[model samples]
Target: MAGALRAMAGPSAQPPSAIRHPPSAIYNSSRPMQLGTYRLIDRLGTGGMGEVWRAEDTKLLRQCAIKILPANLAADPEWKERFLREARSIASVTHPNIATIYNIEQDGDTLFMAMELVEGEPLTKLIERGPMIPLDAVRVATHVADGLAEAHRKGIAHRDIKPDNIIVSTRYVKVLDFGIAKQIGGTTDANLTQGNMVIGTPHYMSPEQAMGRSVDSRTDMFSLGVVLYEMLSGRKPFTGNAVTETLLNIVMHEPVDIAKAAAGITPALADVVRRCMKKQPDQRYADCDELRTALVKSLKEDPKLARQSRIPTIAVREARRLEPEPPPRSAVSSHPAPQPTPAPAPPARGTRAHRALVADDDPATRYILGSILQRYHIEYDEADNGADAVKLLKNREYSLIFVDLLMPRVDGWGVIDYVRGHRGNVAPRVFVVTGVQNQKLSAADQDVVTALLYKPLDIAKVEQLVQKSA
Candidate 1:
């Protein structure tokens, strides 16, 4: 539950008041701490906001996270108000991508807020593993932008949008800990004061934020850009040996080009990152929604994400379905009940509409590649092995075939030979996918394959190839 309910930053540097209350009754109890209807099962974490507990609601029998205000802070009206403000900020918006706030309750001196207990690793942990495949990075960024767009629409700006505040689950991503979120155009408060405190993680702060200028929705975009850059390169865009140096870098430095940082990242994707991290807020994406669109357009699907992310294929399908469909034109039935046109034969090679065949023994690869094709409204079929692919090719022609070089039964070489030898005129463009690094194809393979792509495919490159040929 600590993974689910961890809070932002640690306790404040400000000293505790002279009159400290006795050890709270909530913790002193031998049994699990009971705060009204909630049974606090265990302490999850502690931060400046206070302690987080994994709790169960007796009435609903549902698991929840309880963020309790520190006893010392609860005694101070200003701190108490700030804690309540965080709760209110989260409660104002109900979105699938944003964590949910259930209710605010007080148990005598112990005040707490109940919320959804998210189950996932933090984006920080994912980044620690290594740079994510570019497609996955964009997919996560798209979800984050979507959540931010909703919050922005509600006139709230998540002042702290960093990897530590994002949770990535198999089913979906959730933006967490809006403790520092501010309502756009709202009156000045504690956050804006200079020297006393600097809001947000320094490496992710926007130039405007670093200089203590007013902030709006665009501030979040800059932070998101830093995050996306890290996801693609496994490095923060702005960094320093010290906090002040980092802040100065944010204020005045240009980050190393993403392409140089991470090889093979598509230009279109790198541009999206560039636009997002523009020093001036006005120069960044107009809004998070626009950023989300750019992110989706930059790439299609990642094979690794498909296999490991656990994000359902339906999510991609539904996202693609967002494009407006042309309305059906009125049609009059003819008098003689004209026989429906015979199901048209599958289009011949090079004559087909956007259609593809994916042949791979790995079901995960087939699933993801098919999902990408589906997203682009391309018709496609799958074959687990090369022989089935050859059989399918014999009956139904496809404009594109993505075949693994190695497979059970007939190998890719056989499939290529069948296509090259039998197909008289127009042969489907065949792309070879293999796990071998620095693989050197023989002269024969060079003649047969349209292109050779290594394993853990670069999805953007795949998308570009598909768009150009399919």
Candidate 2:
């Protein structure tokens, strides 16, 4: 997982290393060495909005981290408000896991913030090296969630909670950069966003965030789920070739299961990950507190779970590719398998010799899928239940499989478990397309399923996704 994900670049899109400030002499000649009562010692890091520096609070004779808002940005009244809002958001949350904000400074057009100087490394850097020690992974997530729980209780939501924004010091896990935090229940008009635009990093965003919906405390839980998965699996939960595609993936796809990605991930721990990442906000943990309690229980039940760290000591396992098999005739036909008025020739398979399969008990749904596949010129097979799907899967390697959660015989989740655990099984991208009310996947299924969509299936999205693979 780590080997495959080194290419991800995490949520910040920054390299998995902390910014190393150059000599103070570099900034001394041009940028002001002093601002108000603090003297800039050196830069800590920089973002689109501004740079942070290791500064000395000459008035108090103490060291602090200072964030400076860019002059260009300060020129914009809206940005100025957001800058001040950022300060208030951080100041509102007082927790061991959250960095403290001391004061906001306005030196003429230059605006800056005095904050705690954390001597630590970015969690992204640790992730790049591979997964963490299991116990450490749980502790890091629990501590952060606990902190966010308090902030949420205070009606604040940290919209951006990703690896780069997290720092792991020798003794503490500190969440940094609340610059995107929003007051819970704040109007859409109150959002720092320009217009109705959504603001967040695509990779870790919740489906609601991805769709630009009204977000709440659960939004941070979704992002935390992404962080936890990456910490335990050594890979981001959702990823893509482009930003829009990644956002679409978050809203439209299910990530590979963590237990599969890393050997021996416990059911309890996996459940925590699953609930935290539910696409619908209502499907996730009620709040960060609930999430924290679950994390705590998981640790209490199996202290040895920590001993089975997915952190690879030898070589990082590059995720295996899915196998492509010949098409098979589906058993237990539902709705008499849709037959085109005029029998059409089998759709031409792509350069990749792969058979796509659709397994669902619903005759109408199967009919729809069959028709769409025919129009897209993609050859496919169908299964009416989990048992038949497994039988077909065994006979032929599939390139893609769309499964229904509540079919007779074996369930969708059972099929996934079987396929994933099968020896030398080809890794076909599996999607769950169902009308099951509030369908919830087992922790293991979360890692096995590729994408999920609620019925009535969006034929257009199905066409687009299938065509790309084709």
Candidate 3:
């Protein structure tokens, strides 16, 4: 499995420099540039065919996401027309999960589309954090399916549905980059001529798409299935170092069983994923809605099946929904003037320090948590068992506590119950830190815990949690 991942990692891991262009060169050129009265602030991101910008709509007084085709691409009348057609098709489908397009405009050499600016990180960033828990994965997939169902209802198909294009925010999921998406039965002669150019990320491409066959809504389902698989398993189902080999696998090979790859994953969940990933579009779920129904069923059965699955020592991380922070105040302006601002007072000495109590029978887990807390400048107390943790809690008031589920003497759940029952009014927020990935917790008990941080903790994520609690 390691060798397979290593082989498939190369092509997908494009160098940052290769994918991004210098922002100034694209927007600051001597060309008559105005995208429907919106002045470009700066380039936000770029891709192979176009550039996305952070722009201010002077007419509307709002910030919007602006995608622009470069002069060279826009000059090609054939590609230019197809691009406009794609924008129109995407604009026609309206859903909460899909980003809304405000307008399409042309100003001399520049052609661009203005849309909503979603404040969130892409799924790619979330995946980089760690593997997501099954429930969270199901939630995200369901939302995406809702959006796709809307599109399919309108006979529109999103040809590309990969991690890089799906945004995860505190309150919503926004699907972005509908560059290659098309409306079924609405293609022009120009589109038909531009043949054989593949679209979509290689690893997530559906078999029909990879084989250059005609596609439908099922194609999107297959790609999303791959995304869900990666979300839960922390790896793509089919992969290879060479593009041809990867494409070949998607066209002819079957993916490894997800349950086998990730222990503790329910068989029902794995089967649902496999069905959606079937090589033949007809063999897969009829549409996004059907696939979503299967996912919902799988989630409902997960709790029962979880008890039977062998628990793994390694922990699965929940994908964080990043919240946007207020922009920092600027000290200087581009107008060559400096603004004077009062310096903030320093924090009170004792008030700034926070203590966290960590309880775990595993010496390694305790050591890891201690090291992470230290790196974040958090004071911590450790106990080997739940009883020891409760004892320590009685004497010292901790801001946060991390408890392991299975330990000598009193277990983690026992400690939680004791604290909740006896110290109801004053108990500190407890974070149930455990390695048992599939353990079922009663909904009532789950509410008392501030949050659950799985084992194999990423120090950065641990610090983030601690900082948030502080």
Candidate 4:
């Protein structure tokens, strides 16, 4: 796994699959694992099904991607055959925007499939620059939509479509990881696990997919709609404290309107996203082709979109363009411009109703929150654990409380229940803070808490929350 991921930072390209050597050769790995003739150079990415590696096809003398299942999976004969059958079926797909599968091979217990090594950053990383410039986002989506259209034509439905699975290079966008793609009219891989369980990540799955309902190309469209929504909003359409909670949100709620979520996005672009995200498959574009056509047509018809597309990278617009370069300084003033005077500190938390509290096992986290709150002229108290937080809440009322979800005793949830259950009318609004992944909030926490923020907090959003509370 280490060797495979090492290759992701350096992706090398070769000629297309049309001109590649004939397959099959057996070779064991020495230092760098080698299966058959394809010497595993590095691993590119991994998922629930399998992990992909960057390999050097010694016979073809070209670089390619090889996906391999876990050794434990080979013991299950039914699963092994299903993997091979699915790999062969997925290999049939061929498109510029889609990674081409080269060959599937079994060496001892190791089963692998060689494929195209996409040289670029995942859209997930690209989005960290903040919400994308709308046009560049649409252009990237159009490329993926084109690939989906082709797959739909071949009677294949890519069950998983997320920013993590899509690559965006300087020149082009490529869709990847077809391991979960199901054949339209054949044995669908809908329920690989017991009790007819649905496969695919929750953050990007359609409501129907989340509910274990039959999915078609429109299922992929719904996922694509989520990716587009994230690209424009810097956040997924549906998110909760836990995966099950997220799925419930997807099935039961409509996302906040995109226009209100992000500035600079036009009504036309927002409408297109809304249409693609309609919970019912019937409400969405009839098919991938229709979705692709709508995206392209929208891009052409909107003048604002045309100008935005010319910018190329989405991050550039967000991190740079919208703010624009500052004017050249007037050759340093003879006397520095009068220094602004600092404002006087306000009174302590004990004196006001706007008092806030920070609860965490770590003093450093509590300190950071204290610093931010202080700068905002908002006085706040501190609690080292959930018990202390509950004690403070029981005795007094506060305007806000930032508490860690995981702690030694009576964790974040304990404090939340105490305040909501005990304090009721005069309880402070809760702001959950935690480093723990897969944290699930109680129903009462949702109603009582103002928001849930992960550890290594987003300073800007926190400040906004402070201002909102103030």
Best-matching candidate per TM-score: 1
Candidate 2 ranges with C-alpha deviation above 4 Å:
1-29, 188-191, 194-197, 306-470
Ranking by TM-score: 1, 3, 2, 4
Where does candidate 2 have its weakest 10-residue lDDT segment?
Answer: 315-324
What lDDT does model 4 reach?
Answer: 0.69
- Each model's lDDT: 0.73, 0.72, 0.70, 0.69
Alpha-carbon shift of residue 149 in model 3 (angstroms) = 0.6
- Tens digits of lDDT, candidate 4, 56-159: 99999999988776566556665566567557656777887898888888887788788778898899997987776665677789889989998898888887
Tens digits of per-residue lDDT for model 1, 83-171: 78789889999897999999998887778899999888899998987777766788789889989999999988987888988998644
Q: Each candidate's TM vs. the true structure?
A: 0.63, 0.60, 0.61, 0.58
Q: List the residue pairs that clash in candidate 4.
A: 4-42, 4-43, 5-43, 42-54
Question: Which digits, one per residue and each the tens of the lDDT, describe model 3 over residues 1-470?
Answer: 32443343343433222332356545556634457688878777777447788888998899998888877778878657656866876788889899999999877777888889887889988677666667567767888998999998998778778888899864467777766676766643311223233545778888777665677788899999999998877788888767667777887788888877656667778888888888888898988888878877775443312222233222322212231232455567232111122233233234432578899875545756775455445678999888898898777666678988877789988888876775534456778877656657788787678877765554446656755554
lDDT against true structure, model 2? 0.72
Model 1 segments more than 4 A misplaced: 1-32, 190-195, 300-470
